[model samples]
Target: MAKGKEARVMIILECTTCIRKSENQKSPGISRYISQKNRHNTPSRLELKKFCPYCYKHTIHVEIKK
Candidate 1:
């Protein structure tokens, strides 16, 4: 059985320079979001909001790593 709630990890993502006309700007985008109510060392699903330096806006992201 699982001991506690799944772990939550935070990853930083940068926008493609070509996509946006911005100078050297790196944003902290939520690269992962998972909801594993069992795993202990694994990440869990949760609400994450991060700002994109290139896009200059906040975007929603989901867990993509396992």
Candidate 2:
């Protein structure tokens, strides 16, 4: 069975720059970050600045559906 909608959700954030690099065949794999947000408190999708090892710099990590 699926979990209830009221439960806190964990979102996946992926590096934009890393994704571009990967599509261009410059990276071995995609970089991702995981974070938890309260559904009621944060209804909108979250965007965060996080360190990407592949990018070697901080980049915008946007929330993605599971």
Candidate 3:
């Protein structure tokens, strides 16, 4: 059986840049999906994919201490 507390994560989504825009916004696609599922389902420990704002792509992520 698995042990220890489940790692907390900050789901950072990809950022979009436009010539007419000065700032980029984080995408909500992955965050919404993960949050929705986590709300209604049992929790489990596993590596997950999250969109990176800086990278502008889906990237594998591990928990980091703030």
Candidate 4:
């Protein structure tokens, strides 16, 4: 049987702080997280508060295009 389109799609979430302070490469690199969400569930961009070792704090992470 042929499988239909996947309901869940993988997405990447990047730290907002890291994006703003991209110039500061003192630590290592911009903080990014790999995650998945239901395309049908969330048509808009997904945002979440996650931990960032680079920022050493929880920051808002927004989904970015792959």
- Model 3 error, position 63 (Å): 1.1
Q: Per-candidate RMSD vs. true structure?
A: 7.6, 3.5, 9.7, 2.1
Q: Which candidate model has the greater TM-score, 1 or 3? A: 1
Residues 6-63 of candidate 2 have per-residue lDDT tens digits of 6588899998888787777868677798899999888998999999887788999989
Q: Order the candidates by lDDT, highest first — what do you get?
A: 4, 2, 1, 3
How does model 4 score by TM-score?
Answer: 0.85
Model 4 agreement with the true structure over 1-66: per-residue lDDT tens digits: 776888899999999988878765554678899999999889999999999998899999999999
lDDT digits (tens) for residues 1-66 of candidate 1: 874543544433333332333334544432322333324553454334655443466655433434
- Residue ranges of candidate 4 with Cα displaced over 4 Å: 1-3, 23-27
Model 1: residue 47 alpha-carbon error in angstroms: 4.1
* Backbone collision tally, model 3: 0
lDDT of 3 by residue, 6-37 (tens): 45443322222221133455433332123322
User: How many pairs collide in each candidate, listed in order?
Assistant: 5, 0, 0, 0
Q: Which segments of model 2 are wrong by more than 4 Å?
A: 1-4
Report clash pairs, candidate 1. 33-62, 33-63, 34-44, 34-45, 35-45
Comparison by lDDT, 1 against 3, better one? 1
True-structure Cα RMSD, model 4: 2.1
- Model 4: worst 10 consecutive residues (lDDT sum): 20-29
Report the number of backbone clashes for model 4: 0
Two-way TM-score contest, 1 vs 2, winner? 2
TM-scores of the candidates are: 0.31, 0.80, 0.30, 0.85
